[model samples]
Target: MKDREDILRQIEELQKKFLEILANNPGIVVVNSDQTGQVKETHSTRTLAPEGEKDVVVEIENASATTHAVTVLPTIYLDGRQHPKVYVHLGEATGALPKFKPVYSNPNLVIGASKSHIMNKEGTERFLKEVLFIQPMPKHMLLLIDSWPLFLNHSFIQQFVPQGHKVTILNIPKGGTSLSQPLDLNYNQQWKSVMRRLNDAILIHEIDYKIHVRDNLLRAISQVYWCFGAPRFCEFRRYGWYKGGYLDTHPAPFVTPPKYLFGEGSEGDCTCGEPGLILCPYCEKPHCFICFVANSHRCA
Candidate 1:
């Protein structure tokens, strides 16, 4: 086994290499795409009620009867200028995948529900051709990714590298994903949180209409589209290099600083000046778009 000092040295070297790549490529477009699975509506937690009033428990009846999962592949660019793309995986039961809904034309959504919900070779190729390829980006682009088998496929590399789309697999040290992977460190949690809120909204709507939301592929598709199509969702793609200390601004080098490291004062109130432009589903607190972005849309 390696000694503690030796392991630390190796980690430092790995980070140094990563930073070197970033420093060398100033304007390179960094792309990251990841898969997230969402199941049909789940049981809501039981809540307390006032005295003499019984607690009403909302449970998903026959929860296992109509099992469904949505595999979402969200592609984000480092620069906030480019619009993000999100693809939804539909299982085999949903025959003949539908074209993306008209409203979400810019983000370019695709549907594939055959054999598996997870991204496959075909889906990957389609995404490259339809989403990434068509983007009006620079000649040289870097795709930051984890060690996913599909991403490392020989055919995939052969098809893209010659065209100047380079893929770099992050060498994630043990327990280092939060520090190395952009999607893990910055995007996925925010995406999932938005997904949860969307799911909850759908469930509540179903309850109001006395409709069963389970096994409803259309509902699932709607939720996926709404969440992914949201402008805030696309804006959530922050680069990990800046957050992980692999890249830094002026007056800082080598040393990684804590969040809000510079003596920047606390964030001021939302620019909108409207405290309750939108009400949070969980907390029932009103928040403007600025507040939502600053707080990651979580209940305070």
Candidate 2:
């Protein structure tokens, strides 16, 4: 657990080293990898207790995440250029993944399961194999990761990340992940927020399905992540790198989900005056409610 000063000093030295490496090889793909956990969320929508009766739903106080809840682990990476892909692992020793996953439209996502909703060695391998390995060979590769035990397995990494062609692994010091890791600085939170909003919004709209159910849960997960292909997500990826102190210039003039969905300030509106416009899947243009939803836009 490095102190703030130590972390800053280490980041400075690391930035210097990274710049030197880039100065020599500009085509190197720097990857920041990490996993995050999300609980199979039950409705947090509050309801009042009837007279002489207990509340219909009550949340446990400080419930244990590891032992109690059924969680899902989504492993992702941002290469500071493209939109990140997702690898979701079902936890609680549930059976295999959903019989039919909805993420087929995007062949990049890989969904799996583990006893603990945590990224085990196998999960790590699958994540790389499914998400990272298939990428076109770059001039060189730099894997920036947290000091997770499995990530320390040089042997396992060599299985796919080719050792000789300048395969460099830089670990973010333990307990310093949020302070120094690009994916952790802000991107993960936004991703999860969008994921949650997507699920909750569908449920609220009475989508005629149970979002907490395994298949539907997987569907919602896939649908939310499919939007990762949006070019603006790439901007968020690079902005995260700059925020993590890995890049020299800020990825400014950027608008991530948090800004677009909920305006950071005054927001422009369409004729319908809908501030929350959905971007067209094909054109990336903002769509108003009447035009996109009521009128039945091309890409539903």
- Clash tally, candidates in order: 1, 0
Task: Please give the TM-score that candidate 1 achieves against the real structure.
Answer: 0.61
Report the Cα lDDT for candidate 2.
0.59
lDDT values, one for every candidate: 0.49, 0.59
Residue range 255-294, candidate 2, lDDT tens digits: 7764554343323454466653456544455655345433
Best by the TM-score measure: 2
- Candidate 1 per-residue C-alpha lDDT over 1-300 given as tens digits, one digit per residue, 9 for 90 to 100: 466555556557767776677789777666666666655543344342335787645445574444555676766666533344566665545543544532212234565566656777777777666656565645666665555777655466547544555545444454445566666765566555544443444354342321123224434343333434343333333444456554453222321111111112222333456433334333434444335432345332
Q: Which ten residues in a row have the lowest lDDT in candidate 1?
A: 254-263
